[model samples]
Target: MVRSTAPLLALCACLPDPLGRCQTNTDCERGPAGSFCAENVCQGPPRGSIEALPARFFARSETVHVRTIVDRSHGEPAVHVLLGSGAVAAAREPDGAFGADLPLRFAPAGSEGPVPFAVEVKDDLGHLTLLPGSIQIDDAPPRVSVDLASIPSPAAVRGSSVPLRVVVQDLTPVTLVWTAGGAQGAAMQQPDGSFIAAIDTSKAPAGAPSLDVAFTATDAVGNASAAHASIPLTRLKFVTRHDQPIASIVVSDVIWAIAQSEIWILHRDGTSLTKGSTDATPVAEAATDGHHVFFARSDDKVCRMGSDGSIQLCCGPFTPLTGGPILLGSNPIVSTRHTATTSSRLVAVLDSNGICNQMSWLTTVDFAAAMPAVGVDGIVYSGASQAIVAAKFDGSVWTGGHPTSETPSYRGQAAIQGNSVLVSTTSATIDTFASVPLNSDAPTPTTVQAAVAGTVISSPTLAEDGTVTIATNDKRIVALKTDGNIRWNATLLDNATASPTHGAGGLVYVGTAGGEIIALSGDDGSAIWSQKVGAPVRGPLAPGCDGLLYAATDASVVALVIDAAGLADSDWPRAGHDIRGSGDARRPLRSASGACLE
Candidate 1:
């Protein structure tokens, strides 16, 4: 009984008590490396407290190195960087601080403002803590732009204060610099993110035939942009004609000026030769075949005179015409209003021995007020119906169907090239330059159409290469290929009312309502030169063989000498300078000498 009791006592002593040993963290202080007393057991230190150095700042394409100090009383802590949803482990430094490189680009692309980040610390016992922080992002640089208005005129006179305007755009304050004559100028900013600067040409260098102006614009972020322009300077020669506005001008061996009811001839030296008068009526316009000048009186009487102002022949009083007595192979084709009530008629008055032989007419509907363009095979004109009608000299006529179905309003005069006819039309529903084949038998001619942005206000001038030049009411001069493709365009300061004329050396001349004549390169539409005539020009430019450009303004006739070598002794004997009113003089007229009359 004693031996059994002793074994029971030993077993009872070996059994442990039911009460736990630890209740708080302080009770198990001397345990493992990261041990802490919790839940009646020793454990590691609580997740270390993370403190970031220099909490937050802005970054632009810069690396943000985050240094954090983690406090873990019981053991060292593992540190990491939380950028958005991604985590990057940090390296511990010799000073006991944790660091991680956070590139600003790590943020979302094109992101701005504060980017959230955190320094996280974890202990060996799996406890975690986070330190919240942020960084502002602004890495984009400011943009800059520059523009120059009216830098190059066709011709700028020396000592003239040519007006120049410069415009700049930038989000922040911009520094603008411009050089005119080593003289720098600054621009003032406007509320609409634009700056304006004016350049005075009077301060340019002496004897400078050309002026080169350079401009630079710098933004707040050190971004810069630049631009430049060139201007040509020349001397001007002016010729005055009648006191009243010169209605029309034609240059040959002599310059002819039509005003009121008389035609006066002026030599190159601006001397008046002789004056001829229409039979008590105003003439529409005159034409020349380099031998004789012919014009139609308002009373339907067609008169002919020599280039020297000698009266040749006068025949007509037949049918009343709206405009033109265009000479086709010495025969006159007039756009006549048959009776007081009829639409219109294109009458061909046949002449032999300077006498009217037989008069034949082509009846038309909706005939335009302008003259018909004469081709080798036929005559083309815009009908009142918005259709283009071509009347062959053999009495056969072909019509191009209406270009637009909505309304038919035609602008400018028709131009005939071989079997093709070019015309401009603008209506509420259509504004286009159409090339129609005159020989086509289709009821509605299939035309190559080029859309125009503005109302064409002048007759189309056909070039030697079949290109067509037309001026719009919006001051734009456009050139088109025979296939209706745009060749080039030039914008003027004011509306261009005069038709463009071709000259020697691939040059195209156009006159503006602002009294300015501009010469453009036919190849690329670049400005070759420009001149201000000081009066409104409403007539086409006539190129003389003397290398001079003859144009009539509101008050006088201007003969501009552009290229001396280009003068070819050609005669501008008529308004359009040719039988077809083509405004192209391909052959030199024998009547004029090689010497410049002016």
Candidate 2:
């Protein structure tokens, strides 16, 4: 056995080290750390300033870790580094930059750049010295830029295609991302710098949303550029609060008001929420009893449309007059100079005794048929249907008034109240029209009396209990007993043309050319309140649907609140003109019948 001074030396001589420490006895002349004197650690000539890629290069680059210089004395030399934490370790290439052979798969993140800690110089003597700036690392993040055309494109010509382009650039490779269209579409990225996407207008509506397109571009460094641009699109149909209706026609809850042309569903608040017809042709007058709508048709047919949009006509021979008469349920009323009242399908019209023209007669049509047409010359409700009943010239051709026992002085049209026809006829005769149930009833008025003589009868209105109220053009509102006797008399702003509509608060309303709507005590006809809505009162006034009053004027529609506390005067309608477009009927289109075609 070879005598050994240390057991370690003997073991080293026996086994071959894969570390390539020593090959022959001659190699041992350098010892475990190379060349004998070096102890503990052994290393070959440290790689010369390692050539790193991305020189001091960024982006995890490969590196070269190999001996650069050889030791003539053949001593162990190892590359080492001193850490900030007072630790010592192998010294890597001066630069952490990636090298070809010794690759650095990882890159320093959030750091200035590849950072080198310290470098160590080793000698065969087993001595080491830490060099403060032995390594040079990279610092600096990449700069990126993105280009976007933020201007929104024009409205796409309904059916066409448009291109949206975006460009993203970076000091390094860049990923371009984008989102197009809506949820139906998808988002994606094109590794390339600029991307162009096609937006088919053919798939869009007329007025498609040409909203600004949004996008973002980020370089590998996580730097981003926010972008925005308007896209051009086609048009189809778009509805928004931007759209406003020109006019609305409203009437009683159960009835449709014969407004300008179209049949509009009525609301108590005077708001006509339905889409009105823009046609020039007049339709028909309908009534809503707060529920279903009853249309008084002059075609001799009574039609009804429910609030739910259901439509049907009660079958009958009742024909509407050329000019539809005032409609009550299916019944239509019209007065003739010759005194013949005809309706939609009614073959038989009631005739009165009077000379055509000067003769005035109020004839009621069958409750079964007829529809009202549009225009002011169409239907006119007689203020009261008693003596001297108000006559209408529904544009057709019924001559003047005629004489009759129905009350020659009739003015106020009769209001049908629970089984009784209350006629506040001719300011003077307050009477009730009840078919006495004959032996099956009793003795009815064998002969109806006429107005005392000369006095002209004003229109009459009635209360729930058959009390008659009549108004004379003379500005006075008179109340009468159910038996044609005067109960009380009240005055008004001016000549009253319309019938009185009673309210729940024991108040009565009437319209007058006096340019004001007067409210009077239901019983005494005493003035309770007055409001001067713009323009002279035309016929009667529609009581508010929901505590508001509605008035018709050439200026426009207006609403007024019922203030029992005496609210001050105001001009709320003026403001409405600002929001709604100033009425401009420039559109060439006429009747919805497709009549006025260009």
Candidate 3:
């Protein structure tokens, strides 16, 4: 050890060429498969050499991000990444690590699904490495569609409830958005391939109204598909029988009654119908007890039909007071007659000629024996049934006596209110005429005015305000009070020879000779609104539960909704749909290819 071996110096010279053309420690030490010698140091990689960062992809309106890290790549640790042309250089960090976030604003619409993207990386040594695969951008357009298997044209009626169907296909799971012109309501696509929706024209306005429904399917990726359908809404009127030519129509709660040969339900409107249905066997009399209507037929049959067509009773052809069935001796006279209900019981008039002895007079039936009615009062002045005639009681009845003071002749419907009874008179000149003063010995005249004349078919009906309304062959709606003073007269269209009907809220509804329905102001007799519909309506007006008017025509039954809010035409809802953000700026909806929902 004192002198040191002579071979040791030679061994140092042969150790490994430590300083030869190396930029890193790895260049000098090749230890394992993953390790290598570089430069003049024992580092991981050769100086200024790096692999590229992974490539990125972009989809519908999304972004891509990439990063490059430096770890012992040696020689100032410089790095640079290559991207598509026009790509700005991403800022590098002080530690030689760089990151970039690419805002992908190039997602296309109106195109099919599943698009593509690409990216690569590089190092300071001018070395490059591409990613294993290209990035995929799936910014596809939405898929929208419709079923053209069978196209159904719009019905003739204006504003009828109709349903349209369709199927849709799209990318990235989509939902269906429906718009009418500018109205909007999008429905979710069900698991089943088919879709169903209801478009209600009931709430839609009258006339040649234009309605366009557009269906658009948009995927979550913003892709979309669309289709459209257009329809015209025609106005309609209500009638009782669908087969017979409708003369006039009326709705009471649940039933739509028309004057077809006999009164029957044309259609069922609401949920509750008390007075079911009736026939034209000459209704001796009819009484409304709010919920139900009871009829006395000429055959001495007491039939009660709910407005809904539910047959409540068929009671009658009863045995007379003396013994036999209480019936008339004459073949022309009807036996079972009028009504005057009392609280806690129902009462009716029995037309009988004692022992069928060839003389026609009226007998009485107990309130308990008669058919029941809704709001009747027997007490000296309860409410609906305040007045009782001699023909309504059995014990003190007037048998071979003159007809009850409240007798109904072979004309039309009559209303008995308190001490005053309103009846419609048939004449040739005036549309409506009335004779009042029950106790007064008034003279019955053939005609009211010698100046004007026409064949009036129905008796004059009195309104709640004591104004009598009559329809005549002269095509006029005349209103008069008990004093015979004329309130007002409405001249109808010459060709429109149909009768008129009075509804609640003092509104007068009438049908014209030319298939038109007009609502008039009851107070001043002014036209509220008029619209032409279905076939020529021949029937009378029928009142609905909510003061709605039901009219009958030769074509079909129609219903009308009153405009109570009174909005201006231009200010109407859904009217501004023609303009929106993209041009017709109004609502968020895009199209109307289907039905409209309230």
Evaluate all candidate structures by whole-model CA lDDT and list the values in order.
Answer: 0.60, 0.39, 0.41
- Using all chains and alpha carbons, the TM-scores for the candidates as numbered come to 0.51, 0.36, 0.50
Runs in model 3 with CA error above 4 Å?
A: 1-62, 68-85, 93-97, 106-122, 130-140, 149-163, 180-184, 192-195, 198-203, 206-211, 223-226, 231-499, 502-508, 515-535, 546-598
Please give the clash total of every predicted structure, in order.
17, 98, 87
Off-target runs (Cα >4 Å) in candidate 1 are: 1-235, 280-284, 307-312, 318-320, 337-343, 350-358, 378-384, 394-411, 428-454, 464-466, 481-483, 564-598
Best by TM-score: 1
RMSD of candidate 3 to the true fold?
Answer: 14.6
lDDT per residue (tens digit) for residues 480-594 in model 1: 7756678888888988756677665667777888888887887888887777788888566666654456778876777765653232222332235442243333333333554
Error of 3 at 91 (Å): 3.1
In what order do the candidates fall by TM-score, top score first? 1, 3, 2
lDDT of 2: 0.39
lDDT value for candidate 1? 0.60
Task: Order candidates by lDDT, high to low.
Answer: 1, 3, 2
lDDT of 2 by residue, 1-598 (tens): 8776798888877764545465444544454443332232233333334232233333333342422231232344555534333333343345432212323333243334335544455655455543443222222333323334523343543334455666654454444454444412322345564655554444432123454445555555444565555555422111111032212223444223444544454344344445333233333323343344443343333344556544433322232333233432223333222223342121212222221121222344222211111112222223222222212343244432221234323332334333333333333444544422211231132222223434444434445455556566566776666555677778665776555555445566676765676777767767765656555554444443244445443233444444321111111111010011111111111236523111
Q: What's the residue-level lDDT of 358 in candidate 3? A: 24
Model 3 accuracy (lDDT, Cα):
0.41
